[model samples]
Target chain A: MRLRLLCCGAALLLLAACSSTPDESLYSDGSGQLGGPPGPISPDGTIGSADLNGGQPAPGTQEDLELTVGDRVFFDYDSTVLSPVATETLDRQGAWLKQFGSIVITVEGHTDERGTREYNLALGDRRATAVKNYLVALNIAPERILTISYGEERPADPGNDETAWSNNRRAVTVVTTVN
Target chain B: MTLPRSPRARWLPALAWLAACLVLPRAAGAVVELDITEGVVEPVPIAITEFHGQTPAEQKFGRDLADVVTADLARSGLFRPLDRRAFIQSPAELIDLPRFADWRQINAEALVTGVITGGEGGTELAVEFRLWDVFAGNQMRGQRLSGTPDQWRRIAHKIADTIYARLTGEKGYFDSRIVYVAETGPTTDRVKRLAIMDQDGANHEFLTDGGDLVLTPRFHPDGNSLGFMVFRQPVPQVYKYDLLTGREARLGDFGGMTFAPRFSPDGRWLAMSQAENGNSDVYLLDLDSGRKRRLTDHPAIDTSAAFAPDGERLVFNSDRAGSPQLYTMRPDGGDVQRISFNGGNYGSPTWSPRGDLIAFTKITGGVFHIGVMKTDGSDERLLTESQLDEAPTFAPNGRVILFTRKDYRDNHIRLYTVDIAGGQVQELPTPLDASDPDWSPLRP
Candidate 1:
C-alpha cells in the first residue's frame, strides 16, 4: 500500500512540472547560457523571480546592466557620499569584476532634473568620480574606467517624487568584457 | 518682353524718371490689409548692391559688409537675396536713383546699397537700405548708416533688423542664439546635456557630456557664459560655465538646493532660489565675490527669479500667497509686490529685455500656458496653451518668447516661439527633441 501511494505522488509531481508557465520553462546552463527547460520551481520555490540574490540573471535572459534606482545608492536631500549598503553592494560587484578579470567599465553619474545645468555638470562629475574612485580602490585599473555625467537629462523612473527622484539620483557602473 | 531701361541703369538720369512713373503705380495699395499669420516661408526678396569706397581696401570692406548682411539675413529662414547678376544698375546709381521698376522686374522688394570710406581707426563703412513696396513701385523706408570696418557686422544686423521689422512687423532673430538642455535616449534613461544653437536653431553642440542632470541653463547677459544648477549626489549646487573656455566653477555654496538662477543684465550678480530645510527662497550671488545675499525671507517656495532689464528690480515666482504667483521687488530685496493675479499658478517669471513686460508659465484649469504681462502685471496675454509649456525666454527685442512645449504623451518636447502680441506662434524643428530653451542676449 505504501509503494502504491509513492507511485501516485510521483505521477502528480510530473503533471505539475509539465504545466509550468513559459517563464518557468526557461533554464540556464552553468556556462550562463540557455540550456534546457527551467526547473518547475526555483530552489526557493519562487517560479518567476529575479535571480539577483544569486548574482545571476534569470534563465534565458540577456544580461541587463541598465541601472535602476533600486540598484543604485540614494543620498539625503543634498549629499553624494555612498552609504554603507551601497558600499556593500559595490563590494559584491567588485568581486564579480575580479572574477571576470577582462571587463572594461564605464560609470555614469546622474541627478534629478531639479538643479541648473552648470551645477548639475559639476555635481554629476563628482558622483561619477566617486564611483570611479571606489572601483580603483578595489584594485581595478584606473585606465580601464571612463566617467560621464547626464546631470538630469535621463531618468530611470519619470515620476516626480521621492520614489522617482531617488531613482534618478544614481551612478551606474556598466561592464563590457573583452572577447 | 522688353521694358524701357531706366536711365539709372545706363548712368543717365533722364530715362530714370520715365521708367519710375510707368512702373511706380504698381506699388500703391488700397486701404484693405491682411494679417500674415502663415505663409509658405519663401525667402524675402532682397538685393544688396556692392558698396563703393574711396580706396580699394574700403571697397573690399564694402563688398564684405554686404556679403555679411546677405549671409545673416538669408540664413535666418526669412530673407531671400536677389542675385546680383540680375541687377540693372551699379550700386552707386542704385542708391541715388532706386528705380523701383528695375527692382520689380527682378522681384526685388527690398534693396541695400552702400559705400565705405576710411575712418579714424577703421574703414568707415556706410550702408543705405530701402524697404520698397515693389508691386507699388514705392519706397517704404530708407536709411543710411556709417561706422568703422569692425562694425560692419553690426551694420548688417541693423539692416536685417530694420528690414525684418518693416516686412514682418516683428523683431528679427538673426542676432541671437538658444541655450537649451539637449536630450537623447529612451524615456526611462534619457541623457541630457547642455547645448547651444543659433537663434534659428542651428549649430547645436553639447557643452557638457550626458553624465549628470542639469537644469535651467540661462545665458549670462553677455551671452558668453551660462549659469545653472548641478546635483552632486546630495547637494544641488549652482555654477557658471564660460562657454568659450569650458571653464566652470561653483557660483555659491547654499548647503541645500540652489536653483532657478539668472544673471543680472550687467553680469555682476546672479539671482536664484535657495532651498534649506524644504523652504525655498530667493537670493542673489555677487559674481566677483561669490557672496550670497538673501532676497526673500518667506518660508514658501520662492524660485524662478529674474532681474529687470534695468537691473534695479527683479521678478520671481513665489507660493507664499498660498499658490504660485509672480512677484516683483527692488534689487535690494525691498518693496516686494505682486505682479501677476489673473489666475493659475505662475512660475518661471522672466523679465522682458525691453523692461516693459514679464513672461511666465501659468498652470490653470489643468493646462500649462505661456503668458505675458506688463511690468506692473497688466495687459496679460496668454501666448500658448498646451499640455506642458514652460521656461519662456524673451528675444532681445522683447518681441518673441521661445519656450519648450511637451506633447500630450509626455514623450516628445519641441521648441516654439510666440510673438509678444499673441498673434503668431511657430514651432522650431530639431533633429532631436529639445527643452529648456534660453535665449542669448542680443549679439554685441
Candidate 2:
C-alpha cells in the first residue's frame, strides 16, 4: 500500500513539472491582423482588447482539455444509439477538433458486464462508430481518427451498480498530439 | 491351500496355516488408521510387454493390441510405460514362467501381459493385467477382458480408466472432448466460432463458420448438441447446434438480448438470462414446447444461470442487492435467497457436477479469482487468483475445472484444471487462444 502511494506521489510530481511551462504571447496589430503592437486607432476602429492576463499563448497549443468520462455519452442497455446529450457533447468535441486542427484523437468504447462476450464486443464497436461518424460529419478528418473497443474487459468504474454501468457504457476521446 | 514346495517349504506351510486361523471368524476384526496426506505426482510405474501370437493372424493382432494399450496409458498423464529397449525377458518367457524379481528391479509396479486367439469372424484379444504393489510386495488387482481386434482402442482406454481410478480415487478426464469458442482478429472485428476438440486439445474442428459471432457454447446432457448464443442477423438469440444433423434452430426469441444459455441435466429445459428494455432477468425455456417461464423479475441485471444436477434449483448472478452477488432460487422463482456476500462482485455461477458446490468468478482488490462455495454460500475458498479470470466450468467427474486465464495485454488464454480442493493445477495445452471451455458429459 505504501508503494502505491509512493508511485502516485511521483506521478503527481511529474505532472506538476510538466504543466509548469510558460505560455506564449499573442498581441493585436490594431487592425485585427495579428502582429507586434497596435497602430493608431482609427475613428471606426473597434478593438475589443487582447487577453488582459498577459499569459503566454504558446504556438500550436491546442485547448488543454481533459475529456471527462461519464458526462460525454450514454448508451441504452445493449444498444449503442447515441443519446441526445451525447450528441451535444460530441458537437463540442467536434468544435475542439476543428479549432485545434492539429491533434489526432482516439475514441475508445466500453460496455457493462451484463451481456454475452461477442454481443458486448459488437456493442462497443457500434458505440465508438457512433461517435466517430459524428466527428466526421462535423468536418473532422476521418483519417485523423482511430478507434478501439475493449468490450466489457476494461471498466472505467468497477462497481456493479447502475452508476458504474452508466459510466462504463461510454466512448472516450483521447488527445494524442498537436497533429 | 499351500503350493507344494520341494526345498524351502517349512515357512510357507506355517504362513498358510496362520492365514487360515485369521480367516476362521474366531478372531475380532481390527481397525486401522492411516494418514495419507502426501502422495507423489510421479506417473504410476507400468510395464506393457509385447504380446505374442501362436497362429499367423494371432501374431498380427497381438502386437497391435499391445501398442494401443501403451499409447493409451502413456497419454493419460497417470502412468509411465517402461521402454521396450529395457525389456530383460522376452514376451514368451514372461507370460509362461513370470520372474517377479526382474520386473521389480526395473521399477515396474504393474505389468500387463496378453495373448491373441483366432475367432470365427474377427481376432479375439485375451488381455490380462496384473497390478502389483511393488512396495508392499503383493498383487493388488488383476482382470482379463476379451474383445475383437476392431475394438482394440476401447480395451486400452478401459485399462487406463481402471488404472487411473485405482491410483487417484477420482474419475479420469480422458475419453472426453472440450467445446469452446475460437477467437481471432482484433477486438472490434473479432471472428468467433464454436469449435470442439479432443480432451487433449487435438483434432480441433470448427462446428460453425466465423461468419456470425458465437458465444458461450455449452454441451447438452447427451454431449452431441451445444447450446449457444449466435448473432446471425441483427438480433441476438439462442440456438442449439446439433452435431449429427447440422441443424440450428432458434431457442425461441425473448425480444431483447438473450444469452448465456445452458442445458439442464435432463436436456428438457434451458436456463438463460434475457434483457427486456434495460433490465435483464433469468428465464427458462422448455426445449420441447418452446414455452418460456420468467424466473427472476427485478430491475437489476441477472445472468449466468446454471442448474443444479438435480434440476430442482438453480444458482445465478444478480445485482439486486446493489452488487453482483450470487443467488439461488427454485425453478419456479420461489424461495429466493442470497448466497454470496463476501466481497466486490461475483458472476458466472456454475454448479459443480457433484451437486455439492458452485464455482464462480470473484472480483476483489481489482484482481479476478475463481472461487467455490457450498450451496448455502459458506466455506468460500478461492482457487486461482489472476489479473483476469472468468468462465469457470467443471469437468464431468467433478474433480477439476477448465477455465481461461488472461495475463498482460496479449490476451493469450490457456485452459487450466485444478482439483476441487484447489491443488494439482495443470495447464491443458491448446494450439490457439481458447475461452469459454465446456467439458462434455461422461461418455455413455
Candidate 3:
C-alpha cells in the first residue's frame, strides 16, 4: 500500500512530461477521403445546381442523355429477364448509342439488399450483361458497351420498403466517355 | 483422462510457468480448474487492478494496458471484469499478496495484476503479469513480455490471451487482427476502402485510398496478405494487398469479371467467382505459377467458396439445385454433394477452423440469419436473425463468430459478434460503419 502511494506521487510528478498524443498514423493513413460525394440531389433527381437549365437538352452532356434517352431500366425481384418496359427503354438507348457512335457507355447492374453481397454482385453482373446483350442485339457494337456490377453497394433508394427496393433493383446505363 | 493438447503446441510460455510451479511451495488448496465446456452461460467474474509503473509514462501505459486487457476479456463474454471502484486492494498490495478475503468479498473468481518497468530512455519496455485463482489462493499463470514501448497494446493482448487460455483450456483470439470494408456516405454513393485494425477496434488504418470501391477483404492463411475485389477499369477484378509492403497486384488476367476471392488454407491458391456470358462460376488461381483452374462448370451461380481446414475439401454455395444451397466437393471440384436441405437459400459458407461445422447465411422468407451446421449439413442451428445479417467470420478458436448486421429500418450496418453456444450478441465498435469483416489468423 505504501508502494502504491509512492508510485502515485511519482505519477503526479511525471504527468506533465507524459503528455503525448496517441500515434494518429496508427489509426488512419491520413490519405483516405473519408466521406461520400459532395452536392445534394434535388427532388427531381438532378444533382446540385446542374438543373438551372430547366432540364434542357444540352448536347453531349450527362443531363442531355437523361433528357433525350432514359438512363435506367428496372428489373423484377430476383429476375434478370427484361420486362417489356425495360426492353423499350433499351431500344431507345440502343438508337441513341448508334447516333452517338463515339460515346462509350457502361451498364451498371444493381440489386436489392436482400441477398448475400457476393451473390448480389453476381446477380448485378448478370443484370448489367443482360442490358448490354440487348443493346448489342439492337445493332449497337459490342465494343462500345461495357458492364460493371455495383451489387447492392450502390442503391437508388436507401429506404428498406418495397418501393425503395424495387427502385434499387435496376440497371443504369452510364456514358463513360464521348470520345 | 489426459487433457487435450493444442494442435499448434504454441503454449510454451504457460508451460514454462507451470514448470516453475514444481519447485515452489504448494498452496493449501488445489488450483482451481474451470470447466469452460458449457461455454460461458454465466461469465466468470474477474478483477483486473491497475498495473504499477515506475515512471509517469510507464504509469499511464500501465493503466491503458489494464483497460485493454479488461475490455478484451469482457468482449469475449466469458469473463466479466469487476469495476475498478469496487477494488479493495491496491496494485502494490496485490503484487506481494492479494487479500483473498477482499477479492472474495467482491465475488471475483479471478484476479489479474501486473507491473511495467524500464522504457524510460532507450531501454526496452518490460511488462509482467500474473493471473490468480482468487478462491484457490494460487497463481494460475504468469509471464513477462518484453518489447518496444510502441508494442504495449500487443503485450496487453498477449496477457489477455494467456489468461483466457488458462481458464478456458482453449487458445484465445485476443491477439488477432481484422480486415474489413470501411463504409461511409449514403447508400447510393457509398465509399468503401479496405481498412484493418486490432481485434478490439483500435489501431485502425485504411489500406486503400477509397478511389475505387473495395469489397470482401479476406486475409490469406499466412495473414500477411489480403484478397479483395476492386472495381478497376470496366470490370470487377480480384486484387491482392500485401500487408507488409502495401503493394496491390491483380490476381489474374481473365476475360470475365472476377470477385469473391478467398485464399486456400495452405495459402497457395486463390478461389473466386468469375462471370462470363452472364453466368458466374468458381475458379481457382494458383498464386505462385499464375495458372487458372476452373472448379465449377455448372450453369447456375457458384461462388463464395471456402476450403476446409485440412485443405482437401471445399464448401461453396451454388444455385444449381434450383435455389442457392451449400455444397461441398473435393478440392479438384469432383464428387459434389449438396448439404443444405432446408427450404431457404444458404450462401456464404465459411468453414470453421475447428473443421467440425460450416457457418453460413440462410435467407428464408426475406429474413436473413447466420447459422452453422455439420459438415454433412445435418444439425443446423441459426445463431442470429435480423432483417439483414450475413458474412460470418469465425474466431481463430472457432467458438465465436463475427458478422455484419444491417438494420433495414435505419439502413445502418455494423459488425456484431456472438458465441456459437448462443449467449449475448455483442456489437463491435468501429470508427465508421463497417461491413464484410474477416478476422485474421492468430498472430504469430
Candidate 4:
C-alpha cells in the first residue's frame, strides 16, 4: 500500500521518478554490475579493511610504522618528484618493510583535486613510483612492494585549499592482503 | 514490479540498445538558424498545454508528461515555456483544434499539445505531441512516440526532442542519459558510486555501491555498454560494463594502474592510459581480438586518449613538450601533431559528435575552463570558467557540453552544462555531489 501511494506521488511529480526509490533486485553481491545506490556500506579502504581486528597494533607492527615512522610521503602540486622530507619518511618506511617481510605492502599514490581525474591518477602513479624507487634505492626488495594510484579519489585531505592539497598529495604505504 | 528493474530490462525488454533508427518527418520544417553562440537572443516563448486524456487520473498523468516536455525545452535556455495557468482552456475541453488567439494572448509564439491514451496498463502508452506555430496557425511538428508506461518520461523527452529538431535544424540532446560518479560522505573519505539518469536529472538510479570507487564513466557508441575505472579488489583497473546484460568484464590486469577508458566511434576498440613504474602512456585494446596495442611509448605523461569522430585519428593529452597540451595522432601512434597552444595546460579532450570540434579542460590563471576548438585546434573558445571545471563531455547532438564544476567556497563539486557556443549555464540537480558526467548518445 505504501509503495502504491509512493508510485502515485511519483505520478504527480514532474517526471516518472518512482523508479528512483530503492528497488531491491538492483542490489547485488558485486558479482554482476547491477547499478543502484547501496546505502550505508562501510568504505572498503586498502589499509583499514586489512586490519584483522578493530584493535590497535602491537609494537613494531605495520600499524606502528604508520604511528611511529610515518607511512606516507607528500608531494608538490603536479610533481611526482619526492622532496628530502619525502625520502626521509620513505627511508623509515623501507626500514619498517625490511623488518616485517611476511606481509606484502601496497603503496597508494594519491593527489590533490587540482588536476583532471585521469591526469591526477597518472600523477599519483608517479608519486607512488618515486616512493617505491626511493625505498628500492635503500636496497628494499622491489617484489615486496605493489603500487596503486587512487588519484584524487581517496584524498587524505578533502579540503580544496593549499593546506588540504598538501596533505592530500602523498604516497601511502598500506599493509594489506588485497581485499 | 517497478518497471522490471533496469539492466535486467533496461529501455527495451529484450534485444540490444543497438539499431535505433529514427523515423524522419514526412515534411521537413525549415531548420531555424539561430546563431546563439554570439549575442543574447530572447528565448522563444512556447505554451505547453497539458496532455488531454479520457479520465481524471489520466488527465493528471498527462499533465505530468507535459511538465517534463516543458522543463526539457526550458532548460535549453532557448525556450521560454509559458505559464500553463494562463491558458484559456484546459486541453481536455478543446480536443480537435486549439484556439490560436488564446495562446497568442499569452505571447506564446509556439504551442505544444499532447495526448496520452491507454497509459495505465503500465506496459504501453500511445503518446502524441504536436507543435503548432501560434502565428501561422499550422502544425509545425508532430510525433507519435509509443513507449512503455514506465517510459513516459523518456517519451516526453522524445517529443521535446522532435519539436526541438523541427524548430531548430540541430539534433536533440533530450532523450539521453548521463552516467556520472555520485559522491557522498565527507571530503576526505568520500564514497564515489556509479550513477545513471536521464539528461534532465530524472529517473535516477545508482549503478554501483560505495563499497568500491568508480570514476569517469564513458558510454559506448551504441549506448548499451560503459567503460569506467573501478578501484575494486586486487587493485584499481578499468572495466567494460554491458548495460544490457549487467556483465562486468575487467579490461585487463596490465600489471599497473589503468585509468581513463574511452570507446572508439566504431565501438571496435577502447583507448586508455596505463601507468607502470610512474610512466604513463596511451594504449588501445581491441574489443574482438582481445589484444593490446601500445600507442605511446613516451617517458613523459601520455594519457587521457579519445578517438576523433571520424575514427581515423586519436586525440589525447600529453605533456611531452614540457607542459600538458592536446595532441592528435593516427591510430598507429604516428603523425604526432601538437594541437593546443592557447597559453594554458590542456587535458581531458573529448571530440564532438559533429566531428567539427573538440572540448577539453583548460587550466589557466589558476582557474579551469571548459573550452572547445576546431578539429585542427583553431578557433578555440572557452565555454565555462570556474574554480575548477574538468572532463567536458559533448551532448549527443554536439551542441552542449556537460562538465564537472568544483566550487571554491564549499569545495562541493556539481555537474553543469554549457552551450557548445558558450551561451548559458544550467546546473544539474543531483542527490549528492556529482562529477565526471559523460552524456550518452540519443536513446532508441
* Model 4: chain B TM-score relative to the native chain B: 0.92
**Model 2 lDDT per residue over B1-444, tens place:** 322111122322211111111112222221111112243255667787776667766666666666766775675445788987787777777556457678778987766665555532554555565444544444444556555554454445555555555556666556567898887765435677888876656557777778887888999988778899886544568899876556788888666657779898999999987765445688999999999899999876677889999998999887688667899999999998999988777878899888998999888876788889999999998999877677889877676678877654664667787666665557777766777899987644
What is the C-alpha lDDT profile of model 3 across A1-179, one tens digit per residue? 99877755554443322233333322211212111222223566422234333323345655545545567787887779898767867887887887788998889999998889998888898899999999999999988888888889899887888878888888888889888
How many clashes in each structure?
33, 6, 1, 3
Evaluated on CA atoms against the true complex, candidate 2 attains a DockQ of 0.03
User: Which parts of model 4 have CA positions greater than 4 angstroms off?
Assistant: A1-59, A95-103, A176-179, B1-5, B10-40
Candidate 1 Cα deviation (angstroms), residue B374:
1.4
Q: Which candidate achieves the best lDDT against the true structure?
A: 3
Clashing pairs in 2: A23-A56, A24-A56, A24-A57, A24-A58, A25-A57, A102-A179
Q: What interface-residue Cα RMSD does candidate 2 give after superposition?
A: 8.2
| DockQ, prediction 1 | 0.12
TM-score of each: 0.60, 0.64, 0.84, 0.84
Q: lDDT tens digits, residues A41-136, model 2?
A: 224522222221112233223223331112146677666777776776677677767777887876766787654343354456557777888889
Overall local distance difference test of candidate 3: 0.82
Q: Which lDDT tens digits does candidate 3 get at residues B66-139? A: 99999999888888999999998987776687889999999999999988887676466777788888888888
Candidate 3 stretches greater than 4 Å from native: A1-65, A95-104, A177-179, B1-31
Q: Per-residue CA lDDT of candidate 1, range B1-444, in tens?
A: 111121112221111011122122334572112233453355567887777666777677777767767776664555688788999978667646677788778877666666565643553455555555655656665667555444455556666676677676666656567888877887676677888876765455778887876777899987778997665654657788877667778786666567778999999999987755435678888889988889898766677789989998999877678666889999888999998888777777888887898998887876788989999999898889977787889988786788888785666888998767664568877767888889987664
TM-score of 4: 0.84
